[model samples]
Target: MTPEEKYELFDRFCSNELSATEKETLTKLIRENESIAKELKLYQELNSHLDTRFTSEKEEEALENNLKAIGNSHFNRKATTKETKMIRMPAWAYAAAASVAIIFGVYFFGQSSPTYNDFANIPELSITERGNTEKNSKNAEYAFNSKDYAEAEKHLLILLSKDKNNTEYQFYYGLSLLEQDKYVATTRVFEKLYQGNSGYKYKALWFEALNQLKQKKYDQCAALLKNIPEDAEDYLRAQELLKKM
Candidate 1:
């Protein structure tokens, strides 16, 4: 297809007005041309920007009208006997203005949606010693290593409740659950640790992938194992698991 034809097809695709043949033609052009790919991205962004701009404008107009009416109520009494110049707007103007003001406040002031700052201000918890005793930690670790999950779980739960942010607590809590054959709980704990930007990120992911394998969730297990960083401790094991999968 000619450049003009490709451009027209892309526009149609962006507007969702294209037929199957046109979509196929455009897709083929984009695959064969880097310029078309760039143009398609630009068009998508422009379409979104135009939508926001118009919505913001409508909001501003509504807000202005509401404020004008609130100012005119007292003035209208005197103006009623005199030559009146003020006009009344619908109460919906107030709602529109509020919506616009909020939208602008968010767009220009870098104000995020409620959830944007939700996690930001959440206080970080320090990992504390469960009983400030090395023996407890050692015993817990030993129980865990020996696959005596029941004893390990009891100790680990106590440690975790006391110092929830502790990496050791998180790891062992997950491990104990795994040993107890609590596959779903084990998966949830490990998945959280793995996906988080915490210190135990890769470790949790690696271990969770293993837990997935044990549960015979082969596809999910493979995907998670593949994401393990090469520098991570379990990278080699993950690779081995992938091959076995």
Candidate 2:
């Protein structure tokens, strides 16, 4: 099978939804390709992390109830004949509960999501490209790319919690933190991403340089800018920043 096809199957396998034959085929594919095998390992690790981080049934129930309330607002209540049981909660209560639930869900879920924001749609880096195989990456990317920083933060955090070793997610999580103006945390994340050899390596360096520039650390900014690869995607930006530094 092709690499992408194998990746799709691998993801299904991770989700435990692949058919027996598909699983067998994936097993065969992994046997033949070392890169696929490595990807599978990373996917497995991320799945394990998710299982650990967001395993609360109560939180899940609250979120479900909130969603149900939001969708049921238009439904008319049926009068019961037995004892005339009355549903008394106002639509506003449902709305308020759902809002609270959504906030909790976003924060807890983001803390555990598998793809963080700092790396959301970073030019050349796909979650898969950066060794992140989380199922939530796309959703997180959508939220982040659309500038819904709050929603984006939720999924990204969840993803990162699942794959802390992934520099891409860490980078994106950092960017999300930065977007929210969490400068110190953003600096730390970009520092890690900048130091790594992943696709975000140069991008992180550029961001770190930008962060330094923002803080008036001109010498540090220039130093970081100096390290951005001449052929890196952000080369021009680095040069521009350097001139200003």
Candidate 3:
């Protein structure tokens, strides 16, 4: 119902003639809008004034009824004015509304999306390139390249146990953890790699950014991406991702 209809119900309530539905609607409006509650209080006081000041019961009743009708008429006029304002909205109006809604949805969902899968370009780890011919290193390489992250993480752990300072092993191990959604472990490994001065410094920053992206930490991701210099391998990709964000 319109505000006019609601005011009509409120007037009927003041006149001691509220139906069950009008009472419920009035109660709900009072709970929902403080303005309605204040207005209702004033309306009740006006009714009280009509009852107390008038000596003749019939005269009091007629005056109260007219006052209530005037209140109803005032709100009805406002409702009529509102009705006049609402013409048929165009198709483009709906399209514009949809576009606004889509933009709104993106402003929200974009905070969560354009994620790790959207930008991760993790290269296949090669144990032979670093001259580690150990069985576990070979296993880690094969498993990681084949996207078997669970097995890769297990084998990389064994390899890292023997050679703790091998940054290549650590970077790939971080990748394995990240691929398996081991976010905390991935960040730990990547943090060490990023902090150290090695071939993996910028690379570590890039992957850490991807790790942040996976967790929907766009600000952190952007921070890490910005640290990548133009000469860095992932610099172009990071800039592109920033634009999307």
Give candidate 2 regions above 4 Å deviation.
1-135
Worst 10 residues of 2 by lDDT: 113-122
For each candidate, the alpha-carbon lDDT, in order, equals 0.72, 0.72, 0.88
Pull out the clashing pairs in model 3. Answer: none
Predicted candidate 3 versus true structure: per-residue lDDT over 1-245, tens digit per residue:
67788678777988889888778878898999999899889988987887777757778799899999999999999999999788788999989989999999988786545877768887978786667678897888899999999999999888889889989889999998998889999999999999999999999999999999889888998999999999999899999899878
lDDT of 3 at 111: 55
Off by over 4 Å in 1: 1-135
lDDT per residue as tens, model 1, 1-245:
67687677767777899998877877787799898789899988997899888879979889999989977986786779565335565889879989999899877554222121211111122233455555556667667767687887887887778778777587778877876779889887887787678878987787677676666677887898789989997788667666655
- Candidate 2 C-alpha lDDT tens digits along 1-245: 67678677867887789998887887787789888789889988987888866797679889899989976763434323323455567889889989999999988775442222322244422565466466688777777777666677678788878777877677777766666767788788888877777887888877776666556666876888788778998888667655533
Give lDDT: candidate 3, residue 35.
90
For candidate 1, give the lDDT.
0.72
Which stretch of 10 consecutive residues in model 1 shows the poorest summed lDDT? 114-123
